[model samples]
Target: MTERTAKAARRARVLDDIDLRLLRALWMDGRARVRVLARDLALADSAVSVRLRRLREQGVLAGVHAEVDPAVLGLTTQALVMIRLSPNTDSRAYEERLRTMRSVLGAVALVGDFDLEVHLACRDMADLERSVTALRDAGAESTHTQLIARTVAGLGQALLTEEEPA
Candidate 1:
């Protein structure tokens, strides 16, 4: 069999029907109570609780969190940064630097003209400028920054919102 197919088969064996059902229910409602899930799934409360605890222990389920509105925190601007790294720069080192910055919402390595892409939530244009400067100091050869006009689907909402196929 193909390498990718073998990997998929191995992953599939890791989670069974009950595990999938619990994960799906949690995905739908992160804070769902064990009793509620038990009633819905027609399982015992103890069973549901045990499974939930096991999932957490196995690292299958990460802790749930509330999605806070950035505007409420005075973060009024979202910027996308495309970074070109210097030939001698290490992408992992640059990414590590970004991880420590509070304004950086997300960062990823990429291919082509830009070596890295980062998402920033800022208070204003000045904040964005400073963020770009910091990136430059952190081994970015150059950067192109764009202010996000509107977010149609992003920042963990892609799975939450269903859209009609184009």
Candidate 2:
């Protein structure tokens, strides 16, 4: 789908107060039982279950996953690497190449100066260097990288609890 169509599809999901509460509770602890969430939200267990199912169906609530610490996995360094591709290059091909790299956690296509931004988790500086080299080999014309000093907040904190004006 086109970017505008994709945005419109995502915007179509309407989240109400109960959905917000359910998301908040899940963010705090993904594995929380429906009974506990219902108790916390003062709703019936069956109602909470149905709401959760609806959220999943609407793609508002993705799968619950374990949040693993990178340090424990020997990936102690994090970096944001912005890449500018050669003119007329197929960005989808470059993104698919990035997906094959184990160090790349995620990639985002950008609208401005940078063509893409990559989030990387590496064992050390050498690993990061290798990752950059791989990107260069994959057709990145230029790159700007910055080591992440710290994360102030994460995806959980950024989730919307209420709808904003369109």
Candidate 3:
């Protein structure tokens, strides 16, 4: 779908006050018990359950997943590696190859000088070198790596709870 059409489709999923609260609650703790959520929202357990189901059905609530720290897994270093794809490279296959690499935390397609931006978390310089080499093997024509000094903002905060203009 076109970007405009996709955005309009997303905007069609109107989030009311209850929906916002429920989403915020889930964002805080995806594994929170339904009873706890109901109590927090001052709603019945069944109501909370129904709302959650509806949210999932409407594509508002994606599946719950554990966000693991790279450090916890012995990945101490992090870098944002911007890559230019080689000519005739298969974008889908290249991305699939990136997914198989444990050190590649995330990869996103871009519209600027770089074709893809990769988030790499590795054990050390040697591990980072290996990952970059692997990326080149997977079809990166060239790369520019920037070590992350610190994250000014992390993902734990509630993003959707902000007061969006109507």
Query: How does each model score on lDDT?
Result: 0.82, 0.86, 0.87
lDDT of 1 by residue, 1-166 (tens): 9987886656556766777777777777888998999998899999999888877775667688776778789999999999999989998888889989988988888989999889999998898888889989999899999989987743443332234334
- lDDT for 91 in candidate 1 is 85
Quote the positional error of residue 12 for candidate 2 in Å.
6.7
Better of 2 and 3 by TM-score: 3
Residue 113 of model 2: what lDDT?
Answer: 96
User: What's the TM for model 1?
Assistant: 0.75
The estimated TM-scores of all candidates read 0.75, 0.85, 0.89
lDDT of 2 by residue, 1-166 (tens): 9987886577556777777778888988999999999999999999999999988887677799887778789999999999999886789888888879999988899999999999999999999999888888889899999999987755644455564535
For model 2, the run of ten residues with the poorest summed lDDT = 156-165
**Between prediction 2 and prediction 3, which has the larger lDDT?**
3
Which residue pairs collide in model 1, if any? Answer: none
In model 2, which runs have C-alpha deviations exceeding 4 angstroms? 1-13, 154-158, 163-166
